[model samples]
Target: MRSEGLDLFAHGMIGLNQLKAGSLDSRNSLGAILGGGMDIQIWHGIYWRAFEADYVWAALHYSDVVSPSFPDLRRPYQNGVRLRTGLVFSYGEKKAAPMTAACSVQPTQVMVGEPVTATANVSNANPKHTLTYDWSSTGGKISGKGNTAAIDTNGVAGGDYTATAKISDPKTKHGGETSCSAKFTVKELPKNPPTLSLSANPTSVQTGGSVSLSGLSHQSGQRSGQWRQLDGECRHGFRKRQQRYAEYFRRPTRTDHRERKLF
Candidate 1:
């Protein structure tokens, strides 16, 4: 396992002093140590401590001065440095799991000129590191950043295509990359023209009487209607009304006895 963090410790040390009479004495003192270091893995559960350096501070009291005639001769405070290195044995250290990515599209099917969105879901990723997302497609123009992208289906053929996303962590050196793919289809628009039908309520009308005419039109999966009146072989007074699926025309018959033709 590789590890690094702050260290807070209480340390004790013994100091030996030599007197002018060739005798030796010892003194004990306590101090606080604060530092940090890193360990690199050499094998399973075994690591080498690269380096550890700490700042040491302690106060050594030798004698007390009661008069201004004599100054203190002992060092009141002392600063020191400590360096160390060793091997570390760790137990039950857990390694990070491999990264995994899953891709999804908002619409599995769409018509030409429409847009589709692709998204990425990642697992076992390090939250402290920044992630990069790269996107590509077998068909259409795909563009995005981060976790989501937009696909332009304009001018693309009507068939199946794949959208893929690659996720990567720049901070990791190994097992930091993964990819996923999702399939989608594009459909072409209908090519047939709209169908229309026209009918009259009465084939023949008496002079000074009224007649009703209607028309219907159908296109694709929708229906719309529009109404208009035109002068034919016989002139007549007409009025129009619109409806959801049909159009109606109301006209007053004229006294002229000529044969009337409507188209």
Candidate 2:
């Protein structure tokens, strides 16, 4: 038997048994088993004050003779109702959430006015749970959704920059979040190279005489260079000097004293 209500409940059970009579002594016989219990709804799906009672019949037998002096061949009747009651609980496992978040940037080094992409990797998150992402950066413009974002470096200054990703699981029990960052480097465009020019004051010089040699550097700042003279008609090595300003060199008086280009 059972009764249902908005806040209370009751239930019961009964066991049925049967057996055949035999010419010889046998143990199988008719019996009855009955049980009943009731519980109160203490909280949402949970119940308290649950109790149950069970009664079992154990005395039925057969006789081989009609004499009353013979001892009863079957066991004595068991007439006790066992009762039990306790508190009942209902619960479930806690929800998993995002514990740690990490991110990475592609092409970590780039020139000004370049582009980079960032991706996020989350840990300790439930596979079936939905997640949302928020992205930020210390330099450049950022656009993102879920676990991915883009960084535009147009008109951005040259230096190291960082991008961050914040991850959250909306269905988490604790409403926890994690954040991670990635770094990238940027450099300005290259500049034109330096240049050098050399000139000799006297186009021609007499044997055993010296000529004034000078040079200029297109690049600003202190400069140091080398000057060298080459022999012609039968190419041969000559004198060389290391200087910053004008340098005087005596013309060679040897047999190969012909005019030649100075480098």
Candidate 3:
């Protein structure tokens, strides 16, 4: 394979030469061969092939003896180096690139003024490529870096919002841009202070007798309040004259009266 499959070679050969006149001689000689050379692909297959070549190498010598004196005539080897060329074929199924990106938001529901974070997962992207991130939301200010983004819902309207993340390999020639979306809900904080009203099952109760005092509000959840009991003597003359309720009440003495907590 020297010369990268292109070249020529010459060498010497030795053989025995015998004459019918009972004269034996040894033929030891050197020679050279020159011929136009080319290689052609003979057959094509997955693993094997066939090839062929044609060439000639020979030498001729003459004797000047006028009488029959020489024992035998010497001849050069006639066969030259032969080469074979083959063809190869390979077959296989092709596969597509696995470029993809996905996104997810934690705690899909949040109150206004709370911060929510979104994360992106990328697969089959070249690590050597420079990646870019784009984040967008329907109802919040989203700030992004890398594969993560922060959603600020401080002034955002209360409703279901959809957040999207697009991851791009800008350096890639095909420009692999994959995106995914996640939905979240934002609830506005209660604006109106709780509107409460108090009432008793029995407006008038005898001394040492208990009456159920109930309160109502617009809000839901646990509520706490301090309860104080008032004596009839605390009523002013104008309230008494007008048959109105007293403005100020007495401090509660029992633990059960002051410890008013409800849900």
RMSD of each: 10.4, 15.6, 16.0
Model 2 agreement with the true structure over 1-263: per-residue lDDT tens digits: 32221234334444444444476444555566666667665654566756767676656554543355645644335466778787766477233343788899998988788899999988887677788898999999999978999899998889999999988876654545788999999876645333456676586766655666655445422223344556543122123334212242232122222333334
Worst 10 residues of 3 by lDDT: 244-253
TM-score of decoy 3: 0.45
Candidate 2 regions with alpha-carbon error over 4 angstroms:
1-98, 193-263
- Quote the positional error of residue 139 for candidate 3 in Å: 1.8
Compared with the true structure, model 2 gives a TM-score of: 0.42
C-alpha lDDT (0 to 100) for residue 261 of candidate 1? 29
- How do the predictions measure up, each by TM-score? 0.62, 0.42, 0.45
Give the distance in Å from residue 137's predicted Cα in candidate 3 to where it truly belongs. 1.8
Clashes of each: 0, 0, 0
Candidate 3 global lDDT: 0.59
1 or 2: which has the higher lDDT? 1
Candidate 1 C-alpha error for residue 117, in Å: 0.9
Tell me model 1's lDDT, rounded to 2 decimals: 0.68
For all candidates in order, the CA lDDT equals: 0.68, 0.64, 0.59
**Worst lDDT 10-window in candidate 1:** 248-257
lDDT of 1 by residue, 97-159 (tens): 899999999899988889999999999988888999999999899998899999999999899
By lDDT, the best candidate is 1
